[model samples]
Structures are given as C-alpha cells and as structure tokens.
Target: METFKIEGNVPLKGEITPQGAKNEALQILCAVLLTPEVVTINNIPDIIDVNKLISLLKNLGVKVTKIAKGSYTFQADAINMEYLESEAFKKEGSSLRGSIMIVGPLLARFGKGYIPKPGGDKIGRRRLDTHFEGLINLGAKFRYNKEDHFYGVESPRLKGATMLLDEASVTGTANIVMAAVLAEGKSAIYNAACEPYLQQLCKMLNRMGAKITGIGSNLLEIEGVTALNGCEHTILPDMIEIGSWIGLAAMTRSEITIKNVSWENLGVIPGTFRKLGITLEQKGDDIYIPAHTDGYEIQNYIDGSILTISDAPWPGFTPDLLSIVLVVATQARGSVLIHQKMFESRLFFVDKLIDMGAKIILCDPHRAVVIGHDFKSQLKATTMSSPDIRAGISLLIAALSAKGTSTIQNIEQIYRGYENIEERLKSLGAKIVSE
Candidate 1:
C-alpha cells in the first residue's frame, strides 16, 4: 500500500547501475535446490519477489546466509519434505509465481514436488501447463487438486526425452532444463527459450557438472549428471531495468549513464530504442543516454509504413519493455504501433497515460497506436495506480515527465521487481518520495 508522490518536470542526471536480473534470480535460486552443497550467488537483487522465494527456501529447511549486500550462500542440505504439504506452504507458495520453479529441482532430487496455485501479476492468463507438462514428459506423474487448486508431481526416477515445447516459454524451459540435468540420460529440448537469462542458467549448470550444449540457441542438449556440485555464480545486470533507464532518460530529458549494462547480452534492446530516434552511446560496457531536450523521433519502416514495435521471443524485442516503449513514444516526434502479443491485458494501462495527455489509441487488448506529442504538450500529472511491475515503472516514468505533482498508489508492485527504485531515482535528481 505504499504510495509514490513525485514532483514532475524534473530532469535527472548522474550514473545509476541496474540491479541483478530478477527473472534470472528466480531460476537461479531454484537451481540451488538441485544440490545439497553450498551455492554462493553474487549480485542478487534485494527485491520483494526474490526475498519471498528466499524465505520460502528457509521454510523448507535450506540454510540461507547473507554474505553481504547483493550476495548470499544457500545450502539445501536438510530440506523438510513434509512442509510441502502444510497449510503454511500453500499460502506462501501461492504468493509467488517463481515458486513453481522449485518444483523442478525438488522433483528431480527428492522424487516429489508440490506447489499451490502460484500467483503473480494479473497481466493475463499465465498458464502453469507449460511447467507441469514439461516435468510430466520427463517421467513425472502429475496430479492436481481441483478444489484446493494445488499441483503435485512425483517420480522414482526421471528418464530424459526430447520435447518440442508448445511455446518457447521461459520459465517452462527453465523448469524442464533443471529436471533434465539430473535425469537418467541425454535430453534435447527444441523450440526452447534462449533468452540471456536461460543461457546463464545453462552455463551455470554446466559449471556444476551438468553437460548442456547450445547455450545461446533454441535447441538445448542436456546430459543428465549423477550429481551436481555447487559453484559461485554472478548474475548479469538486468536488461529490462537498463531499458527502463533509457526510456526514463528520454522522456524526462535527462542525461544518465547506466553502468555495467552487459552490452553484448542486451540483444536488440539498443537497436529498438534507436528506432525511436533516441541517442544512446556505448562507453565500454556502459550505456550513456543523452538528454532529449529537442524531443526524439520515431523512424518508420524501410517501405515508409508506420513503425510497428512488437514483442517476440528472445533476440527480438522483449515484451517486458513494451510498456516503457509505449510511454517513451508519447514524447517522440512520430507515431508507432505497440503490439503486446504475449499478454492481452498489459496494454490496458495506456488509459492512464491517455489521461496524462499522451495521444494513444488502444486499438485492442493486444495493440495500441501511439502518436507522439513531440514535447509540444507536456503531460499533466494525475493520480494513478500501478497495475503490474512493467506498467508500474512505465507510469512512474510518465509521472516524472509530467507538469505537476503526481501520486502513484499500489507501488508495492513496483518493488516486486526493482530494488530501491526511489533511492536510485533520487540519486539521479528525480523528485520522488515513497510514503
């Protein structure tokens, strides 16, 4: 129930570092359960969702120790299998969508995994079939309690098999990969998600004695290992957060330098922002975004058709940044269409931006046409509530560039992803206060 009271029309300046990848942290943390040895993880973002998962791990008897800020050591030496059937677990496990991932490692090592219906951003229908079906294909028996809304998977031993996923779902692929790494034989996953986060998981698993090939492609070959040894791993900087900072710099006419951005792994994010005519420089692994005092312009397609920005699997534009893109487009010089293909309800937050004086046409649940105001008309600040993590940050960006004070409610959603966001913005001279 926290609120962000922001004074708008304030330009920000200074250097800010993006937090560790939240998505990767989720998958990586769950992988800790695959071994009983000590796993040291660096650059862990202290966000709500990640902390919740850590707490869940502690409840399940994993020994978690804080090494320092953004670092932790976890050893799942004595897990309480009985806790998985408890009411406390049902409530705790259902609160986080990431909790679904622990099932994979649990089922791999202990032969049984149970989870309550996981919950996350209500952006759209996020189905669990992908995670469960992948485990089932790996020789696990799946059962569901319709009345209690719980899922369980168990197997004496898992045998590897090739799987062609229905969709390249990231978390689904992570679940299956975790299970397959300890499975009886070699496994090939086609049409898998090859996002940088997933690649990190594969590489980390390899360091732990799991044989996984094709790190950066859709086809992953995993050879089951007898046992995995723990290793220290450092997470990459969050690309989505980096993209958000780029959009914030443009919309608020701020000059900002984002440090340690992992340039090579960004994959089309910089190019997508350039298509909006935003000027960003690469300065040795850092992204320097200059102030857009004169307003940026959107570039059309080569054939002169309107520029259409859409989300696809990795190596394409990320759906998570489409909200930021839509908000940034509001102050650009031309029009662009934003197609949010993965989630139907994510674009609904555009109505709040429309009220802030952005010229946006919500064509449908999946697409919106945004006509840039070119900074000729400054957005007027207004009261708004954050809908999800992405839309929440997008709204904060819009509010920062607005003409007056704006109040944003339900900012807890924002904290679920971004760590210490208000302080980070404040260090860049943004006038934001949380209450």
Candidate 2:
C-alpha cells in the first residue's frame, strides 16, 4: 500500500541506467531448473515479480547464492519435488505471473509440474491456454482443477513434434522452448515470438548445450538433447524501461541520458518515439533525450490522416510502452490514436489522465484518441491510483509534468517491474517520495 507523492512541473536532468530485462530474468531463472549444475546470471533486476520467482525457486529447494548486487548463482541439484504439491506452493505460486514459466523446466527435468492460476496485472483476460496447449503438444498430459483454479502437467518422457502456435505469445513460446530443448526428438515451432527477451532465452539455452536455431525469427528449430549444462548469461537492458525514460524526458521537458541501452536490440522503439517528434541522440550504447523546450509535435500519416500507434508482435511497437506513448502524446502538438490490440482493459487508465486535464477520447476498450495539449494547457495535479505496472509509471510521468503536487496510491504495482524507481527518479531531480 505504498504511495508516491510527486511534485509536478519540474524538469529532470542527469544520467540513469536501465535495469536488466524483467521478462528475460523470468525465463532465465526458470531455465536454471533444467540443469543441476551451477548457473550464473548477471544483471538481475531486483523487482517484486522477479524476486518472488527467485523466492519460489528457493522454496522448491534450488540452492541460490547472491554473488553481487545484480548477480546470482543457482544450482537445482537437490530439488524437493514434493514441495510442488504443498499448500504453501499453491499460495506462493499463485502470486506471480512469472511462476507459470517454472512448470516448463520442471516438466522437462522431473515428471510433473503443478501451478495455481498465476496472478499478475488485471489488465485483461490473460489466458493460460497458450502455455498449457503448447506443453500438451510436446507430449505432456494436462489436468486442471476448476474448483481451485490449479493446473498440472506431467510426462515420463517428452517427444517433440512440429506445431504452429495460435498466437506468438512470448511466455508461451519461452515455456515450450524450455520443454523442447530436453525433449526426445527434433522439434519445430512456427509463429513463435521472436522478441529480444525470447531471443536471449534461446541463445542462453544454446550456450547451456541445448541446440536451438532461428534466434530472431518466428520459426524456431530445436534438436532435443538428453540434458543441459550450466552456463553464465547476462540479460539485456529492459527496453520497456528505456522507452519509459524517453517518454518521461519528452513529457517533462527534461534532458536525460539513459546508459547501456543495447541499441541494436531496441527494435523500432526509438523510431516510434521519433515519430512523436521527440529529439533523441545515440551516443555509443546510450540514448540521450534532449529536453522538449518548445514541446513536440506528432507526425501525421503521408496522406494527411491522423497518426496511429498500435501494438503488434516484436519488430513492431511493444504493447507495454503504449501507455507511455499515450501519456507522452498528451503534451504533444498534434493528435494520435493509440490502439492496444493485445489487452482490452489497459487503456482504461486513460480516465485518470483525463481527470488531469489531458484531452483524451476513450473510443473503446482497445483504442483511444489523444489530442495533445502541446504544453499550452498544463495538466492540473490530481489524486489517482495505479491500476497496473505500466499504467502506474505512465501516471508517475504525467504527475511529474503536471502543475502541482499529486498523490498516487498503490505504488506497489509500480515496484513489480521497475527497479528502485523512486530512487532513480530522485537522482534525476524528479520530486518523488514514497511513503
């Protein structure tokens, strides 16, 4: 129940480094269960969801040791399989969305994997069918308990098969890839998610002695191996956080430098922000966003139609940053339409921004049209509650650019993704305090 009291209308300056990819950390941590040897991981983000997964690993008897601030070593040699069936596990596993990933590595090494319906942001209907259906295609028997909303998968030995995914779900693809690496035969997955985080997982698995090809494409081929070995891996900087920083710089008229952003892997994020007329420079591996001293203007379509920003699979705009884009658009010089195709309820948070004096039209659950104030009309400060992780940060950015003090409740949602967000913002001269 933490609250953030942010003083608005202050410009931020300084350099901030993005945390390790949160999504990649989830998959890599689960991959540790695929081997009994020690696996070393670097650049781990100390966030709530990632930490919960690490704790779940410890409770399941994985030997975890802290090597440094953002590094850890994991060895799963003496896992207690019986712990998976306990009530404590059900409660603990249900608290994190990333917990669903553990089932794949567990099913690959052990004979069984069970999990309660994993919890996360209540943005929309996040179905588990993608994860379970992919596992079933890999020769695992699936069972469910409707009364308790629990799922279980078990197999004596998994034999790989060619399958086409219904959707390019990132976590689903990661789960299936983990299972297929140790399967008995060659496997081919078409229409797979090729996001950087998934690419990191596939590459890390290759380093650990699992054969996988098509690192950055939709078609993935895996040659089943008998077992995997431990390997050291480093996660990419979180692109979502980098995008957030870019939006924050634009909205608040701040000049900020984001260090070590993994530029080549950003995949259209920079281009998307540039379309909004924000000036960002590439200084080596860093992104330097100059203050929008005169405010920014959105680009219109070639045919003079309104600019539309929508979420698609990787290599396209990410859905996670659409919230930031919407918030940034509020202060731009022109109008743009934000279409959130993946989740229905994510755009609902726009109502809070509307209260802050942003001209927004919530067309439906999936789309919204925002007419930029162009800094002519500053958003009036207001009280709000964070609905989800991305929306929480979006609101925080809006609060920073608004005219007065704003109180945002339920900041715990913000901590689930961003690592030490308030402290990082404070270092950049953002007037934010958590209580």
Candidate 1 vs. truth: CA RMSD? 0.6
lDDT of 2 by residue, 1-435 (tens): 789999999999999999999999999999999999999999999999999999999999999999999999999999999998899999999999999999999999997899999999999999988888888999999999999888999999999989999999999999999999999999999999999999999999999999999889999999999999999999999999999999999999999999999999999999999999999999999999988899999999999999999999998999999999999999999999999999999999999999999999999999999999999999999999999999999999999999999999999999999999988999999898988
> What is the Cα-based lDDT of residue 394 in candidate 2?
98
In order, the Cα lDDT scores of the candidates are 0.96, 0.96
Q: What lDDT would candidate 2 get against the real structure?
A: 0.96
Q: What value of lDDT does candidate 1 attain over all alpha carbons?
A: 0.96
Q: List the residue pairs that clash in candidate 1.
A: none
Error of 2 at 389 (Å): 0.3
Query: How far out, in Å, is residue 351 in model 1?
Result: 0.7
Distance from true location, Cα of 205 in model 1, Å: 0.7
Compared to the true structure, candidate 2 yields what TM-score? 0.99
Q: What does the lDDT read for residue 225 in candidate 2?
A: 98
Off by over 4 Å in 1: none
